[model samples]
Structure formats: C-alpha cells, structure tokens
Target: MAHLLFRLRHVTEEEAAEVRALLDEQGFDVYETQAGFFRLGVDAIWLADTRQREAAEAALDTYQQARLARERDAFEQARARGEAPTLWKRFLAHPVQVALTLVAVVVIALLTLLPFLGLATP
Candidate 1:
C-alpha cells in the first residue's frame, strides 16, 4: 500500500529550498508544490524500498533543534534589552563612537611601526 510519509509547510521559498536540499542529501526523491500563501508538499516522502526514514528524520530533527536554540537565545537577548532596540540603534548611540573605535584600532598598528619610524616617545 502507498503511504503518506511526511508533509511540511514552509513559510518562505528559501526555507522550502533548504528543506528540499536536506531531503535530497538523504537520497530521497524529494518534490514540493506551492499552496496558498505557503509551500506545502511531500518535502521528503520516503520510499518503502529505500528504507531511510530514520536517517531523514534524524537530519530534520537536528535542523529544527538548532533553529530552536538560535531563536531562544535571540529571544532572551531581546527580553533583556526591554525595548528601543535594533543593532543599528546600539551602534549609533554614542557620537564619535564609530570614528573613535576605528582610531583606537589604528593606534595599535601605528605603535608596531613607531620604533622603526623613530616616532616612539623616548
């Protein structure tokens, strides 16, 4: 009997492509289709003859687990910040912060060459 193995709905095209790549890597004849407002299909329909369901499941489980960990860390950081966020805001908050940071970094390199140029304070 032909059985439905797995079904997945992707929120975006890039996610769908990544799912397809994983399925392909596991040697499954992967295929997909677009549903309304999303992509839904047999992203990794397993063949009975191939019998690789375990490996495919492991790969997907690992992928989702890593994604969850990343999202959780990001959520914790956002909660700590409270609000008024965005990396750009944090970066641009202090006037001359960007220029001063670059200047300080350049000073380290200048110090390395100063002895040769006789510019070292004696």
Candidate 2:
C-alpha cells in the first residue's frame, strides 16, 4: 500500500506510539519509519496512504494541537504547585542536544558576523 508520505520529528517513542494509536483510532492507516542512525533515532516518521493524506493530515494536526494544550496545562499546573521547571533541566538534560544547540548558536553567530565583517561585501 501507499506508505512513507509524511513524517514527524523530535517526538519520543511513547509519543509516536500515542500518535499511532490516535491515527488508528481515527481509522487511518499509519506506520513509522526510522529517520536516523545512532544511539537514538532522530524521531519517528508517520506514514499514510496517498488516498488518506487529507484526513490523515487533519487528524495529526488536531492531535498535535491537543497534545500542545495538554503540555501547556501541565506547565501551568507545575508553576501553580511551586514546582517550576529549571532552565538547566530543560536544556542540559540531553548532552547531545546541548552540544548541538551550542554548535548551532556558534554557527549562527559566525554567519551573522561575517556580513558585518565585510566578508560578503562586493
């Protein structure tokens, strides 16, 4: 059948499972593919048939929005309970993510500075 149409990134295995359950519940044929090679996959890729594209998209969008709302509510509840999350907890929890973020920041700064340094003026 038609698979490998669309995908998502940065979602955990549990999240992917939840999304798969949701899609199945909505009667959409869906599956996941490995998006990267390493200790951890980059993310899960959700696939659907070409014929199911429109409905699949709508369901995924709704599910993601609902998940976002749930996360926002959880954050608000944590703040109300005086258990606010720490910045370091958010950023440095994954060493790979932290290192990649630093690299990205450095690359962006260098790119931004190059034009100001007259390296691109002609």
Candidate 3:
C-alpha cells in the first residue's frame, strides 16, 4: 500500500521542489498526486514503499525544522531592515483598501451588536 508522505495544500512551489529533490537524493520511491480539475481530489506526495515510511518521516521532520529556522531568521532580518511589510506599512501603501476594510468591520460590528443593545435598552 502506498503511504502518504506529505500533503501539498498551501505548500510553496520552492518547498515542494526541495522536498522532491530531497526524496530523490535519498533514493525513496516517491510520487506526487495533483488536485485534479475541480480541486476536490488529493494533492500529496506518496511513498511507494511503506517500509520506508519511518525513514521518510524522519527526513521530512528534519527538513521542516531547518526550513522553519531559516525562514524565521530571514523574516527577522527583513524586519530589522524595514523590508518586512508591517500593518502600518500595508495601510500606508493602500489607504483606500484600509479605509474600506475598517468601514466594513465597523458596519459588521454595529449590525452584530444592535440587537443586543436594543434588548438591554428595553
């Protein structure tokens, strides 16, 4: 039976390619599945040998940890250099979008609380 090694949902292309390269380097018999036309199908990497599942899992875990650390360090460096997009930076870049979102939020909040406020007032 084939064993699912990794789910590809929300995974970046670079990350998926890196994983594929890693598996190929390790000589694991792996294959990938597409999400299909309607996107209702599975999109994942599968291992042909169930016996190698543990080894594959270990390799993937190590890769994920290293990737996490590396990405975090990069993010920190970007933030330090003011290259990271903060909330204020986003707002400044797109003030109209920010204002529209704020207005929508206030409208939703008012709509949600109006009934409760009326009940309390009566």
Candidate 4:
C-alpha cells in the first residue's frame, strides 16, 4: 500500500523542488499527485514502498525543522534591520487603502453583529 509522505497545498515551488530532490537522493520510491482539473485531486507525495515510510518521514521532519530555524533566523535578521513592515510603516505606505479597508471591516462587523446585539438588548 502506498503511504502519503507530504501534502503540497500552499507549498512553494522551491520547497517542492527541494523535497523532490531530497526524496530522490535518499533513494525512496515515490510518486506525486497533482491537484487536477478544478483542483479536486490531492496534491501530495506518496511512497511506493510502505517499508520506507518511517525513514522518509524522519528525513522530512529533519528537513522541516532546519528550514523552520533558517526561516526564523532570516525573519529576525530582517526585523532587526528594520526591513520588516510595521503597522505605522504599512499605513505610511498606503494610508488611503488602509483607511478604506479598516472602514469596510468595521462596517461589515457592525452589520454582522447589530442583529445579535439587538436581540440581546431585549
């Protein structure tokens, strides 16, 4: 029986390529499924041999941990350098759009809650 190894939803192309390369390098018999027409199918990696599932899972876990650490470090570096966006920065960059979005959000929230609030008041 084939074992699902990884899900591909929201995965970046670089990440997918790295995963494929890692699986191939580890000599695991694997196959991939595409999210076919209308995105109905599962997009995932499957192991052909169930016996190799444990090893493949371990490899993937290790890779994910390292990637997570690397990403966190990069984010921290960017933040330290003031390259990461802050609320003030975003508002400065697009004040009008941000104000309009905030207004729309408040309007939608009020519209959604007004009926419930009215019932509770009585």
Candidate 5:
C-alpha cells in the first residue's frame, strides 16, 4: 500500500520541483497525484514502499529544516537591508487598496457587533 509522503497544495512550483528532485536523488519509489477538475482528490507525493517510509520521512525532514533555515536567513538579510515587507510598506505601495480594505473590515466589525450592542442597551 502506498503512503502519502507530502502534500503539494499551496506549495510553490520551485519548492515542488526541489522536493521531487530530492526524493528522486534519495532513490525513493514515489508517485505524484493531482487534484482533478473538482479538486476532490489530493495533490501529493506517495511512497510506493511502506518499508521505506521512515527513511523517506527522515530525508524530507532534513530537507525541510535546511529549506527553513535558508528562508529565515534570506528574510533576515532582507530585513537588515530594510527591504523586507512590512504593513506600512504594503499600505504605502497600495494606499487606495489598503484604505478600502480597512473600511471593509470596520464595516464588517460594526455590522457584527451592532446586534450585541443593541442587546446591552436594553
């Protein structure tokens, strides 16, 4: 029986390719499945041999740790250079969009709280 090894949903193409290459390099017998038109199926990698699960999992864990470290280092470098994205930066980049979003949020919150506030008054 095949065991699910990794989920591909929300994973970037570059990350997926790297994961595929890593699995292949590790000599794991694996297969990939795609979510169909209705998205009912899972998009994932599966290991054909259950006996290799532990080894495959360990390899994946190591790879993930390395990737996480690399991403953190990149973010740290960006922050040091004052290039990392911040809320203020985002608002500056798209002021109108940000203002609209804030308005929508306030409207939603007021609508949600209005009934409760009326109950408190009585």
Candidate 6:
C-alpha cells in the first residue's frame, strides 16, 4: 500500500520541484496526486513502497532542515540590509490600504463587542 510522503498544498513551485528531485535521487518509488476541480483530493507525494517510508522520511527531514537554515540565513541578511518587510514598511508603501484595513478591523471589533458591552451596562 502506498503511504503519503509529503503534502504539496501551500508549497511553492520551487520547493515542490526540489522535493521531487530529492525523492528521485534517493531512488524512492513515488507518485504525485493533485487536488481536482473541487479540491476534494489531496495534493501530495506518495511512496509506492511502504517499506521505504522511514528512509524517505529521513531524507525529507534532512532536506527540510537545510532549506530552513538557508531561508533563515537569507531572511537575516535581508533584515541586516533593512530590506525585510515590516508593518511600517507596508503602511508606508500603501497608506490608504493600511488605513482602510485598520478601519475595517476597528469596525469589526466594535461590532463584535457592542452586544457584550450593552449587557454589561444593565
């Protein structure tokens, strides 16, 4: 029986490609499935040989650790250069959009609390 090896949802194309390459290099019998029109199915990689699950999982774990380290280093470099995205930067980039979002949040909060506040006043 095939065992699910990895979920592809929310994974970037580059990351998916790299994972496919890694599994191929490790000689794992793998197949990919796609979520259909209704998105009822899972988008994932499956291992045809359940016996290889442990070894395949180990390889994926190592690859993920390396990828995480690389991403962290890149993010740190960006932050050091003052290029990493921040809320202030976003506000500055689109002041109107930020203001509108803030207004919407305040409105939603007020609406959500209004009933409770009325109950407390009695």
Query: Tens-digit lDDT track for model 5 on 20-114?
Result: 99999989999999999999999999999999999999999999999999999999999999999999999999999999999999999999999
| Location of the lowest summed lDDT over 10 successive residues in candidate 1 | 1-10
Residues forming the 10-long window of minimal summed lDDT in candidate 2: 39-48
What is the overall TM-score of model 1 with all chains considered together?
0.45
Off by over 4 Å in 3: none
Give per-residue lDDT, candidate 4, residue 17. Answer: 96
Tell me the lDDT of model 6 at 121: 81
lDDT tens digits, residues 1-122, model 1?
A: 33334455434565556666777776764444334445343443443543566666677788778877987889888879875456667667864886778799899888988888895457
Predicted structure 1: lDDT: 0.63
lDDT of 2 by residue, 1-122 (tens): 55553456755767777877887788876666664567364344445567888787787788889989998999999999967767676675677888888999999998989878895567
CA-lDDT, candidates in order: 0.63, 0.73, 0.96, 0.96, 0.98, 0.98
Candidate 3: tens digits of C-alpha lDDT, residues 1-122? 99999999999999999999999999999999999999987899999999999999999999999999999999999999989988899999999999999999999999999989999974
**Winning model by TM-score:** 5
How do the residues 44-101 of candidate 6 rate in per-residue lDDT, one tens digit apiece? 9999999999999999999999999999999999999999999999999999999999
**Per model, how many backbone clashes are there?**
0, 0, 0, 0, 0, 0
lDDT (Cα, 0-100) at 80 in candidate 2:
97
Give the local distance difference test score of model 6. 0.98
User: Over 4 Å off in model 6, which ranges?
Assistant: none
Each candidate's root-mean-square deviation in Å?
A: 16.2, 6.0, 1.7, 2.0, 1.2, 1.3
